[model samples]
Target: GKDKPTYNPKKERGDVVVVLNAAHVHLTHDKWNTKLYRWHTGYPGGLRSRTAREQWEADPTELIRNAVNGMLPKNKSREARLEKLKIFPESEHPFEGFPLVPFLPKPRLLQDRGLGWALPQHLALVRWCPPSLLLTPRGPGLGAAAQGFEPANPERYRFRLRTSPGLQGGAGRPVVGIEDLLTEEERRALAAAGQQGV
Candidate 1:
């Protein structure tokens, strides 16, 4: 009697990857004609070669398998890891009985051109702190207020700063007139210190 292999989730290190529509894989430029797959047939002058286009036409799954095999590390565990990969030329697959989770990429952040407030030369620093500690003080500001400081105002004080370019076109140079964390008294003191070259 042949023994059926049982799956143990705790023992497995990687997930079973199933790729469909292997035939429709796009090859950039002239790779379809230029790329060649060579193999030996274990006989005298048994070396054989096939173009990528010919290989895809004969067995599309093999094309994908070769690509994935090349990408994998050249180690002893490579064969075992490759066994988990299942490729289908078409959308049809036998793994419908098992749960399949589709892969989704994470959303990209908005670039400087996409954001109206963001500039090409300026670096934007956006920080979101708890409202209780800085904005709405039930008793007193435990952190900032305790140090004799508070945000200028709830509406104006948004923990966002834009840094401009410094001398020699270097980044991280702080620009003035956008201070949101200082009170009127603190601003006056800072202005007096600046005038006195402090």
Candidate 2:
């Protein structure tokens, strides 16, 4: 745990102190091989990594700390928490001399990047909002709901009414639904693509 700093909980307004046990951390699939842990000693390429397993052997606690951290919101508290964390290969930590308490990992659902934008109707909603694509009736409907309109499932909302009340009578045009959801997945795939931009 010497890899991290120790702090006092009694000093509520100051920095924090976290003691970690590296031996029992978990990591997703082959991230150990592909994940790169790079750093710099104010010199050239000081990048580093221990192939998950290697890191486990070197400092088991850091591996877990890093895995959990990557899932957190990138912000001030994120940085602070990392600063206070102290990883140890064994249960016996140097932080024992400080206000040491067991650190519990938060149980967070790993939302697929494709599904990150929930509220399926968000796109429809956005298009319907003050500005953007939904500005038009998305093939019909003028801020007015059709017969069985359910806001919860944008798929239930149909927009086949005529643009002009007396026009060709709302014809069937695509109103984005499950099929449209696929594009989100496609976006994620592209996002995960490599070196060259797709």
- Tell me, by lDDT, which candidate is best: 1
lDDT of 1 by residue, 58-122 (tens): 88799889989999778776787789999987668999999986542222222455533433221
Clashing pairs in 1: none
Alpha-carbon deviation at 95 in model 2, angstroms: 5.3
Clashes of each: 0, 6
lDDT of 2: 0.41
Q: How many times do residue backbones clash in model 2?
A: 6
lDDT of model 2, residue 70: 91
lDDT by residue for model 2 over 28-127, one digit each (tens)? 3344455667556775676554465566566667666776689756766566667665556544655557764433222222232464343333123222
Score candidate 2 by TM-score against the native: 0.33
Candidate 2 residues lying further than 4 Å off, grouped into runs, are 1-17, 40-50, 65-81, 94-198
Best by TM-score: 1
Model 1, C-alpha of 193: deviation from truth (Å): 48
Worst 10 residues of 1 by lDDT: 120-129
